[model samples]
Target chain A: MVGVIFKHTLRHSWLQALYWGLGLGLMALLVVLVLPLMDYNKMAELIQNLPPFVRAAVGVGDDLEYAFSTEGMIAVGFFGKLALIFAVYPAVMGMRVIANEEDAGILDVVLTLPVRRWQVVLERFLAYLATLFIIAALVFLGLWAGAQLTGQALDLSKLAVSALNLLPTLTLVLVFTVFAGALFGRRTVALTAVTLFVVGSFALETVGGMAKGSAAEGLRSLSFFAYFDALGVMRSGLAAANVAVLVGAAAALLAAGLWAFQRRDVGV
Target chain B: MVQSDPIIQTENLTKVYTSRRSQTRALDRLNLSVQPGEIFGYLGPNGAGKTTTIRLLLDLIRPTAGRARIFGLDAQAHAVEIHRRVGFLPGELSLWRSLTGLQVIRHIANVRGMRDLRCAHQLAERLQLDLSKRVRDYSSGNRRKLGLVIAMMHEPELLILDEPTNGLDPLMQQEFNQMMREVRAEGRTVFLSSHVLGEVQAICDRVGILREGELRAVERVERLTHVDFRWVEMRFREDVPAAWRERLGDISGVSEVSIDGTTLRVRLQGDFDPLLRAVSGGYIRDLRVKEPTLEEIFLTFYDGDGKRAAQPERVKELA
Candidate 1:
């Protein structure tokens, strides 16, 4: 009973999961392979010439020393902007899990079974978590393989830490979309709302990085993207507190989804 | 017959849906019961609360007031336990299009904790459904057949079906009726809702007629059709006089008397004693009595100015 809905959801989503994992993994591999071709001294000089606001907005380090490092290149090039593409998988899946079924009138059949409504929502969420885990593992393995082929000094532990760090941030988008679906019970409404929220958060994070003083700090604290420190994880290992925040936020969103789903009438 | 406890009961069950603009009472203060080992037909027109009552019985939606029970257990509180023994086929059947019919059946069986799929295979065979084809390729009738198989596979104690024969062909409808008879033979209860008066008349032991969110009548099928008015035409050897027509019209349970040459046509209700006495005269050459169809009987509750509709005298009042 624990995995009844999980198995059904996985059966429907395994192909999409594979496509996303391969796409993200391939991007990571290409970024890692192209890292060594650039001249660090010349790149650092060029970066240093930019204004401080531009540097902060683009997530360039103050000294430009780590700009040419394998960890730094992968973090900024692969994990930062490109990782946003992975959010689409969870977002689409989260909306489909409940809202699509309800809109199609299939939830009436599913809920009439002996299983409780919470079990259906929770199991589908767990399936999405499993999917995110697989995608992260693929990215980590791709980076490891790229490092092996190029004979670079890429630390496998650092790559693993940085790749795995994407989970909590991606999960925040996933659970938020799920919550919207459970609360609204309409696919179009959930998709529109979640897309707007994710895009706004990304915009806020980018602008907040450029702002000065407490303004920048406050805006960064408000954005979910700020908790995902891929560069920091590569350089100084995993940030336990930041991971905890993302995990805590995701947990709360999932709980809220289950609560809303249980209390509301399905297939309305 | 020995009396037993009701398998399904609703106590003033009501559902009022409130949108931002308006409020609609889908089901209003309905009190009904279905005894064990009987096929109870819930007959109503479209939007007449037939589906609403079924949904409430399964706890698919919350009631605005009152409560529903199955086997003495509250439907909302013990939904899971009640569902374990109740098989439900929703009016609008929607399935996972990606899975084959067999796959869908297997998934439901597993979820219901039934390990063996022999019953499902048997049902599919009887329904003439191809289990290997994906549901997306299935026609509406095929999808309905698949829904029926999924609902009946576990041999539940109670079957709640909403328009079960909606998309089936005539031949398939006969088979469905036969299947229901078999379920009753096994002593399981069935609650079926449909707007087709003939279908309900064919198989139901008793019926509850609903109109505009209210229960209009609940009566045994025999009693319902028995009390309905019949069309009677009498032909005499000689021309009938106006006085005889007036005499027949004056009978307690007869109305709409018309006389033409040697023939007279009239509608008769209640006991035929007075009409029989009138027809016993020697001038009558032929007398024909036509029993009204179930549809005609049902229309007595509908298609009226509300006040002129004739009510069934034997129908039990809602509790």
Candidate 2:
């Protein structure tokens, strides 16, 4: 039954998956190809001369030396900036899993089938996860292809790690949206809550990273974006604790969503 | 003959919708039974708990105070198992508008773990539904046809349909009636809800009347339609005399007697023989006696204080 719902959802959303995947992938490819033509030293120096708040607002957290490196250029320029835009896809898809269907009254028809409510929630989430995987894979392919085309000696493993690092943070955002939809059963409420969470979390992480040793710096731990660490993933490798926290949080939210969905009256 | 177990049964099923400002009791202690191999018509006006009862039976909404059972299994606990053997058409049918009707069928079939779509195609053909068109492109009537096809395609042991013929044309409605009859003939059961009395009178074996969240009556269709009340209209050869009005009113089982110029109208409840004899005494140019329509019979249930028909025994006697 889960496979049935999963397959059905995938069939309906394949075109959307392709659109987001290709659009983001092409953007990554273009950014990689264009970065080699720009003067990294001049760009880094100009940004370093800005006020701390201004640089922090742009997500450059007092790391001017790393920002001049090739890895930092791709991480901060492409992945870090595009992460927020990519988060919206999962947020909207998460709401579509339950809230939109209930609003349109399709959930009534769906619940009449011989599928359990839990299966509906779990399968749709898995379907979204599958799409997220495809998007990440396409992004990696774009970066790898750009590296090859530009003849840049970029480490393929680090580039792959950077793309892989996007999954857990985005998954956390997706499940949070799903949780909101299940608990509220209203699209406007779910979208509004998720928008606040995503935008507020990003703002907190950016501002907190700039104000090191200050009270605001402690608030970074409260944001899902704190675990993203795109530059760290590009410079080093994947961080086990970061991935654990992110994936674990996503699992908790998915379970909460499933519980709420099972108990509520659909299409009420 | 011994009575078989009910295909669908409810025991004091109730539902109350509550919000911050108010609470509306949608269904009030409804105890209903539907037998196998019979077409049970649940008739009611709008907001009469007909849809609420159906939703409870399908486990789309939980009851506030009681339980419903289908095929001897609890509706909520065993919903998935029951759903496998039940086909449903909701009052307001909604579908994924981006997909063609054929795609909807395919998806539903896949969900039910059925590989064959021959039955769905046959049903669509019988309904004159075009399966190639997207749902967004279809008219309301065509959407209804699609809904009917979806409900009947699986050939389940029981069917629960709410307002199944709302947007259908007369021809399509006739087809649906025939299809329901075929299902009953195959020893399956149908529980359909509708406010349209003519269709219920045409096909249902038993009818249940609901009003204001209460089940007012459950009686055989023949028994409900066989009430003695009727309307008698007469056109005399000349203007009705003042004395003739007194004479007609003097007849037993006659009420609401009135004379308008050359026409006389009266409501007769019993013993038409006295009415015929009295009319024969007059110079009658024309006489029309009409048995009250099912609509009129149902109106009797709805008329007066709303609480008047709460007792099923009284409703039976009223019928």
Candidate 3:
């Protein structure tokens, strides 16, 4: 049953994943395209002067004496990409899944299958996890290829840790979408809630970063997007505290989604 | 007659849907049962709670009060097991349209823990389904057939269908009926909800008629046959006088008498003797008798006057 669910979930969403891969890959290629003009030495000095709190808000986790050092650039670049993918991929795909099934009346047919109710919700979630890992691999490879072409080999340790940061936050987004799907009576309502959460986080992150102060820094912590600073990981190769927060939030969100789906009045 | 415990049995199984402004009773406190190997027909009009009842049985939705047991297990607690044993056909057949029909069937088969795909292929052939095509491209009848194939391919012990023959033509309907009879021949049960009266009368051993969120009647096909009523209209050569109208009204087993110039419409209760007696005389020129159908019996129950005629126990349960 698990295998069957995975097959359907993936085959059905292949088109969406394909588009995301192409789009993100092109964005990664831009780093290679612009590497020729970058004055690495001057860029490092500028990064050093940037406020420590602002850098932390954007996931600058490690101390950086020379910002141009391969370590510092890799940390910022690695975690930055991780944070964006976590926000983007799930918001795009997770928005419609549960809500769309219910709206289309397909959920009725799905529920009739011999599988348990919780099993259905969980299996789809597992499929989401599988997709998340696959997409993460694609994003990593794209960046690696771009870095190679530009004559800059990323620190392998930094790349691995960067990918790790994405796993937890991506899971959180998918779970939130599923939970919203179960909570609302209608499909549009579920999608709307997911969109609001994703877009709202990004919007708030922009506000907090652009307008700097104690309150702005405090607010940045609330947005999941602001937590994964790739440059920090490039220098220090991932943070213990951030990983704990991400994993904890992901587990909590998935549990809430499962509980809501189990008890809610469905079959509309 | 041979008797066995019912595969599905409910005593006062009720589902009340409460929203903010209105508490619409979808399924009232209704008692119904389907014996093993019986083709039980659950018939009702629109908004009559047929779908609600089916949903409750599958535990897709919970009931406000009362209990439902399938295979002698609590439906809510043992929903997973019940689902494994029953093949369900939703009245509104919507499915994974992006996938091929074949894939849908295979997925359903796997979920039920059944390995055989031969039944699926055979049923597809019988139903004339093009398994290679995506479900979105299939016509209404084809989509219905797809749902039927997925629901039946696993060969579950019980079949719960909500209007199984919605888009089927007469030939296909006959085929479906034959297929259901075969299911019963193997000592399995087929519990179907339908608005198609002839389909129910032709195959069902027993049927329950629901109205206004209540079940008005539950009886064997043989017993309900006695309640059949037909309407007969007669044309008179001469204008029927007021005295004749009064006499016709006094006749037994006649209801809803009407006269418009040359024609007189009168509803009959049972035997057509009174109708024949009144019109057989020289006053009548031409006559036509319209058969009473299941729709009338159903409408009569909801027509308010049939409240007493309907089972009082079931009626009280609705309130």
Which candidate has the highest DockQ of all? 2
Residues B96-154, candidate 1: write the lDDT tens digits: 89899998988888788889999999999999999999999999999999999989999
lDDT of 1 by residue, A1-268 (tens): 6688888777777777878888888888888788889787887778788887798777865646775576787887788767568678789878877888898988888889999988988888888778888889889888988898789988888899898888888889889998998899988898898988788777777788777665765787777888886677778877889989988998998899899888776766
Could you list the chain B TM-scores for each candidate? Answer: 0.79, 0.85, 0.84
Clash pairs (backbone) in predicted model 2: none
Model 2 / residue B185 / CA error / Å: 1.1
Off by over 4 Å in 3: A38-86, A95-97, A153-157, A210-213, B1-3, B232-255, B259-264, B269-290, B293-295, B299-306, B310-319
Docking level of model 2: medium
Query: Model 2 chain B: which ten-residue window has the lowest total lDDT?
Result: B310-319
Candidate 1 vs 2: which has more DockQ: 2
Chain A TM-score, each candidate:
0.95, 0.95, 0.82
Per residue, candidate 2 scores C-alpha lDDT tens digits across B214-308 of: 88778788766666688999998888787767887898889889989999999998887898787776798998998776557766554554444
lDDT of each: 0.84, 0.86, 0.74
CAPRI-style quality class for the chain A–B interface of candidate 3: medium
